[model samples]
Target chain A: MPRDGTATRTRILDAAEHLVIENGYAATSVDQVLSRSGSSKGAFFHHFSSKQQLARALVDRYVEGDLAQLEGSLEATAHLTDPAERAVAIVRHFEDLGDEIMAAQSNCLYVAVLTERQLVDDGTSDEIVRAVETWRVRIAEVLKEALAATGAHDVDADALADHLFVTFEGAYLLCRSTGDSRHMRTQLATFRRLLQSLLGPTT
Target chain B: MPRDGTATRTRILDAAEHLVIENGYAATSVDQVLSRSGSSKGAFFHHFSSKQQLARALVDRYVEGDLAQLEGSLEATAHLTDPAERAVAIVRHFEDLGDEIMAAQSNCLYVAVLTERQLVDDGTSDEIVRAVETWRVRIAEVLKEALAATGAHDVDADALADHLFVTFEGAYLLCRSTGDSRHMRTQLATFRRLLQSLLGPTT
Candidate 1:
C-alpha cells in the first residue's frame, strides 16, 4: 500500500481501537471510526467490509503487535541469569503495561468478549480463550525459566506463574479504578518474597 | 412491618439484585426491576424510593453481609493454628466464592459500580471500595496473627494481605469469564507456597 493508504489504515485502526477502548466493541460503530479517523465510507469499505471484519483485524493487530511487544519485554530480560532480578523484572513488566491496560480501560478486551461469548459461537469463544491462555502461558514460561535458574524446586513455578498473571491482571483493574498504584506495588512485593522463599536464599 | 410487607420487600430486593446482576446498573431500570419482581410502582417506591437507593442498599448489604461473610470461612479453620493451613484457607475463601460469583454472573459488581460511579453517587461505589478495603484490613489482621504464630517476622504481613485480596478479586473476574475453577487451585497453591516461604519450615 502507498503512504496515504497506510496512513488511512493506521488511522482507521487507531480510531477503532480508541472507540472500542472508550465504548466497548459492541457499542462502537464503523461510522464513528470513520468520523474519528477522517476516512470516508469508500475508504473504510475498501479497507474492511464490515465492523466485524474490522474488529477481527483490530484484534489480530492487538495480539501480534501490542501484546507480543509487551511479552517481548520479559523475553528480553529472561537471559539475565539472575532469578531474583528476573522475577522482579517480570513484576515490573506487568506494572509497565499500565498504559496499554489503561488505554483499554479496566477490563481486557478478551475478558469482556469472553463474558459475552454466548452472543458469538463456541469456536470464536475458544479462539479468544486460546489467546488469553497464550498470554498466561508466556508469563509462565518466563517464570519457569527464572525459577529453574534459581533451582527453586520448592515453588510450584507453573502455578506461581498462572497465579501471578491472574493476580496482576486483577490488580490492574483495581489500580485503575481506585487510581492507586499502591496495589501493584503490594502485589509485586508479595510476589518477590514468594519467589525468594521458593528459591530459598538464591545466590 | 407486616409479614406480607416484609415478604414483598425481600422479593423486590432479590429481583433488583438479579436485574443488576443480569444487566448492568445503568441498563437496568426501576420499571424493569418492578416488572421482574412482579411488583407495582407503588410497591417499589414503598420499599425503596429510587433505583439509586436500591443499588446503594445492595452495595451495603453485599459489603456488610456477603463479602464480610468470606472471613467466616477462614475463621472456622482458625483453630488449625498452623500458618500453612490458615494460608490455604484464606485462598480457599476466594476459590469458594468463585461459584457464588459465577451464579451471580454480575462479572465484578464492584468493577461495574466503580466503572459508573460518577453516574450514580448514592454511596454504592464508595461502599464497594470500602468493602474491599475492609477485606484487606481483616486479612491483614489474620496474617499478622499468623505471622506471629508461625514466627515469620521479615515480611510485611499487611501488604501481603492487601495484595492477596486485590489479586483474588481480579482473578475471580477472569475465572468467572473463563468458567475455569482450576486457576483457583493454582492461586491456592501459590498462596500456600508463599505462606510456607514467609513462615519458613512448615514442619
Candidate 2:
C-alpha cells in the first residue's frame, strides 16, 4: 500500500532467490531473507505471510521467467519456413543465451527445489513439474515437425527434443560443480551442430 | 570397535544418504539420521564424530561406488577393437543399469551436495569435483580416440564427453520432477545413437 511497496517486494524476492539458491529452501529462513534484503519484519510479513508462501512465490516467479524465455525463443524462430532450420535455430538461440544463463546461476533455484522437493508444498512442486512438461512438449513438437520435413524416421522426435532440456540442465549442474562456464555454451553448440547434421539438408 | 560396529556405521550412512538426498545437506540433521536409521545417538557418534564427518564419508562411499561402476563398464567393453564402438558400448552399459540407477534415486546425492557445496567442507567438496573430473577426463580420452579413429574433426572430444555427464544429470533431474523414469534410458540411447552417427566408419 506504500509508495515504495513494489520496490520493497522486488528487493525481498531478489534476496530470497539468491539465498534459496545458495542454501536450500528449508535451510533458508524468513529472518535470513529479511536480514539479507534489509527489510523489517513488518515489511517481510506484509509481502509473504509465511516461508511456505515465499517458496511458492519464488517458484512462480522462476517458472514465469523460464517459460518466457522458452516462448521468446520459439517466437523468434517461428518465421523460418523449414521446420528443421527452425529447430536448429531454437537450439542456437539457447546457445546464444548460454553466457547470461551461466552467469545468473543457470536455473540452480529450479533444480535446488527439485532436489529438495520434500521440503516444499505440493503447489510449489507442481509448478516445477508443469514447467518441465511445457518445455518437453513444446520442443518435442518442433522436433517432430522437423523430422517430418526431413523424412527422418530413424530418430524418435521426443527423445531428441528431450536432449535439449537434458543438456541445458546437465551442463548447468556441471558448471556449478566444475566452475567451468564454457560447459554451457560448448555443450549447446555441440547439440546444435548434431541437430543440424541429423536434419540433413532440410529436404 | 564393537562386533556390530560395521553394521551400525552402514545403517547410519544409508539413512544419512537418503535424508541428504531428499532434503539438502543443510536441512538434514544428525538427529534425523539417527531416528531414521533406528540407531541411538551413541551409535551415531561412534560411527561419525559429527555431521561433517558423515558428509565426507558419504561422498567417499558414493564416489567409490560410482568409480567402480565406471571402471566395470570400461572393463566390459575393453574387448571391442574399435574405440568408437567401445565408447558406444560404454554408454550401452550404463543404459542397462538405468533401471537400477533410476530406482536408487539416480545420482541425486552427488547433485545435491554439489548444489549445497557451501554447507560442505572443502574436503567433501573437493571429492565431488574430483569425481566429476574423473568421469569427464576418462570419457574424453576415449572419445578423443574414437574421433581420431573416425577422422571426425568437427566435434570436440571434450564436449562430447561432457554431453554424457550433462545428459545424465539433466535427465535424472527431469525424472525427479516429471516422474518419468524413461528419460534416463531414452536420453542416453539417443546420445549413443547420435554419437555413433558422428563417429561414422572407423578408419
Candidate 3:
C-alpha cells in the first residue's frame, strides 16, 4: 500500500474506534464510521473488509498502547524497597485509567461489550475475550514485580493478577453505572491495603 | 380473579421474570415470553400492556422476592457485635447468590441491565435503581446497628453502606466472569478487615 493508503486506513480505524466508543458496537454502523472518517466506502473497504475486522483492529491498537504505557510506568517502580509501594503504583496506574476513562466519557468498551455479549457466530465477543487476556497478562507482570518487592514471595502471582483484572473491569462498569469513581477507587484502596497487610506493612 | 385466571397470570409473570433474568429486558421479546410461558397473544396483553410493563413486573417480583431475601439476610446480621462480622455476613449473603445464579444458570441480570442501562428507559431503570436502593438501605441499617454495637457511632454509615453495596454487586459480576470466587472472596475479605480496622482493636 502507498503512504496515502496507509493514512486512509489509519483514519478509518481511528474513526471506527471513536464511533464504537460513542455509539457502542451494536449501535455503531459502517456508515457512521465512513461519515466520521470522511473516507469513501472504497477507501474503508480497501483497509477493513468488514466492521468486525475494524473493531478487532481497534482492540489490538488499544491493548498495545495501554500495555506499552503501563509497562513504562511499572518499570519505574517495580524495584521499589516497599512491596506496598510497588502495589500502590500498580493501583495508581489503574486509577489513572479511571481518570482517563471518565475524562474520555467511557467506562471501558471491552467491559461494555462483555456485559452485552450474547452467544453468536460473530467474532466481536471473541475479540473482547482476547482483549481481556491481554489485560490479565499485563496485570500479572505488575503483580510479579510487586510480589518480588518487600520480600513477599509465597503467593500465587498469576491468580492475584487475574483477581485484580476482573475486579478492575467490574469496578469500571459499576462506576459507570453510578457515575462515580469512589466505588472503583475505594475497592482499589482496599485491595492495595490487603497486599500491604499480606506483606505485613511497609512502615 | 378466578382461580385459573390467576394461575395463568402468575405463570406469565413467572416466565417473563425468568426470561428477563436469562436474556435481559431488551433482548427478551414478547413472542419469547409467550413461547416460554405457553401463553397466547391475548393472554400476554391481558396481563402486561407492553414488554416494558412485563419488565416492570419482573423487577417487582425480583425486588419483592430475590432482593427481599438478600436484604433480610443482611438485616439478620444486625445482632453481630462487630461491623467486620456484619460485613462478612453481607458478603456471605451475596456469596449465596453466586450459587443461586449458578443453579439458575442465569447471569445476575441486575448487573447486566445495570451496565447496558441506557437502553432501558429512565422509568424502568428507576425501579431497578430503587431496588438497589432498598438493598443499600438494608446494608446501611445493619452497619448502623453493628457500628453501634462496637460503640463507634460516628462513622459515615450511609457512605459505608453504599460502598458495600457497590462492591457486592461488582464482586458478584466479577465472580461470574472469572468463574472462580477466590478473588472476589479475598477482596471482600480485605473489605471485611478494613471494617475491622475502622472499629479499632478490642481489649
- What lDDT would candidate 2 get against the real structure? 0.82
Worst lDDT run of 10 residues, candidate 1 chain B, spans B114-123
- Residues B44-136 of candidate 2: C-alpha lDDT, one tens digit per residue: 887788888899899899888888888898899989988889999999999887877888874468778777746443657677678788887
Q: Residue by residue across B73-172, what tens digits does model 3's lDDT show?
A: 7677767756667666676655544454556534455554554444443555555566656766777776776677666564556656655555555555
lDDT of candidate 1 over B74-141, digit per residue (tens): 67767866665676576766656655645555455554454453423345567666766777777777
TM-score, chain B, each candidate: 0.81, 0.92, 0.75
Candidate 2 chain A lowest-lDDT run of ten? A115-124
Quote each prediction's TM-score. 0.76, 0.94, 0.76
Residue A32 of model 3: what lDDT? 85
Q: In model 3, what lDDT does residue B67 have?
A: 70
Q: Give the winner by DockQ: 1 or 3.
A: 1
Q: Candidate 3's C-alpha lDDT?
A: 0.61
* Per-residue lDDT of model 2, residues A1-203, tens digit only: 77699899889999999988876677688889999999999998898998878888888898999899999999999899888899999999999989988888644777778777564436677887878778878998998988877766778987888788788888878887777787899989988877876787452
Question: Clash number for every model?
Answer: 1, 0, 0
Q: In candidate 3, which residue ranges exceed 4 Å CA deviation?
A: A1-24, A32-44, A51-55, A69-73, A117-123, A127-159, A181-183, A193-199, B1-28, B141-160, B166-203
* Complex DockQ, candidate 3: 0.27
Every candidate's DockQ is 0.39, 0.67, 0.27
